[model samples]
Target: MKINPPRQAQEWSYSSHQESIGEALSSPGIRSNKKTHINCGSSARMAGNVCANVDQIRRQGRWNNTTINDAYLTNLPRELVRSMAGFPTYCRFFYLARAILNPPTSLCKKLFPAIGE
Candidate 1:
């Protein structure tokens, strides 16, 4: 399917080099041992939801950090990843998503005062 171009075009920077997915992932600094830590704020933590201590959990290797090595994308489809990466890197789409999640009344209001208003 052909995607409609945005009214304002976005420019994407191209990296000089490209390599296989495996090579790209393991090419140093790309791999990570830290698992994803999503903080749902103090309210959620106090309500006994989500982990409060990411380090503690990771130390035990139970819910520890995850490494973003080549094998990390083993389950994810390559085509999907490529498709997402291929899309124009417009940042407006991201702002729309952020506004939906947190609304402008919070931090976004202050951070993006002119735009949020």
Candidate 2:
């Protein structure tokens, strides 16, 4: 079935490049090492690159007290952290399920016709 034009437009608008970058930077789970910096080509690349650097630090047993965790996580809004955590591959399906099971009526009706079927 075809989606409404306005709703389709809204979805497209929400998933823009800027939004993705914002999501990555604002995520609470991302930990960065202050002493050793990874030079990502741009601000956009820094987020993923930081994670990779953390992995490298982990492999060499160099991740000292700089590891990211809930302590620093509290600096970000809880809701935003929750949203970021939901992006992991393992959590995506569960996130979608939760959204479907308890969505606002307007979104539920618009996204899932079966809800009104």
Candidate 3:
């Protein structure tokens, strides 16, 4: 004898406070990219505290007018990408081997132009 109950599909419901997935994953520091900030509690619940991308960091770096060359940061580790706005953790051998080999000399020039010359 079958003792299991039949499964039923439930209707999907959306709350007015719920935000889109893109909005949920977007970082607040990337405002210069023209993304609107969703001011609701659901975004955190939907995306948790760890959502970031390299392209987002590149845009933010350019927006902030940072001296670091974009080429060096393309393959940055996920953690570094997330903290590009703040202080980045320095683990060059493991995380930034490629960038280290090809350093951001432009950044050095911007910081110490006299030495660069």
Candidate 4:
């Protein structure tokens, strides 16, 4: 549960300020209409996905464009979002469902270091 070490081990940054759960999840500088877009801040529990605009979709084709309506944005993959946010491999899966579903698919996709290695 402790992400940071004790003061004897390592000193915390004085400049670093704690953000609220909503602030931690918000996608700043993104201009979005609430009816059409859902930022990570929209739901406290669902930090796994964030609304991506149409321009973002075209720029990044990794997400499924067909699943969402044009009026609304698409959700990015949790793995990707977590990585971008500098989460470690262990910290990426925030909940049980994501922990259960993501690893197998991710492992299958890798070309080297076969399973159980």
For model 1, how does the per-residue alpha-carbon lDDT over 1-117 read when each residue is reduced to its tens digit? 222333456632222122232244466546533212222222323322232344443333333235321222133443455447653343223233334565546676677778744
Range of the 10 consecutive residues with the lowest summed lDDT in candidate 2: 35-44
**Model 4 TM-score (2 dp):** 0.19
Q: After best superposition, candidate 3 residue 116: deviation in angstroms?
A: 5.0
Name the lDDT of candidate 4.
Answer: 0.41
Q: Alpha carbon lDDT of residue 11, candidate 1?
A: 39
Q: Report the CA-based lDDT of candidate 3 relative to the real structure.
A: 0.39
What would the per-residue lDDT of candidate 4 be over residues 1-117, giving only the tens digit for each residue? 123434676764433323222233354543333422243233322322443334464444333445332323335454566666656445434454445555565667585456646
RMSD in angstroms, all models?
19.7, 17.0, 17.3, 17.1
Q: Which clashing pairs does model 4 show?
A: none
- Candidate 2 ranges beyond 4 A from true positions: 1-36, 39-57, 67-94, 101-117
Off by over 4 Å in 4: 1-69, 75-77, 88-117
Query: Which scores greater on TM-score, model 1 or model 4?
Result: 4
Which runs in model 1 stand beyond 4 Å of their true positions? 1-78, 82-104
Error of 2 at 45 (Å): 12
- Candidate 2 local lDDT, 1-117, one digit each (tens): 222334544554544534444445447555444212322223223332334343453444433434433211123443455567674433223344545666579997888878876
1-117: candidate 3 lDDT, tens digit per residue:
222323457433343213332344453433322223332223322222234343454454443324223222333355655467443543232353445475478887788889645
Query: Mind sharing the TM-score for model 2?
Result: 0.19
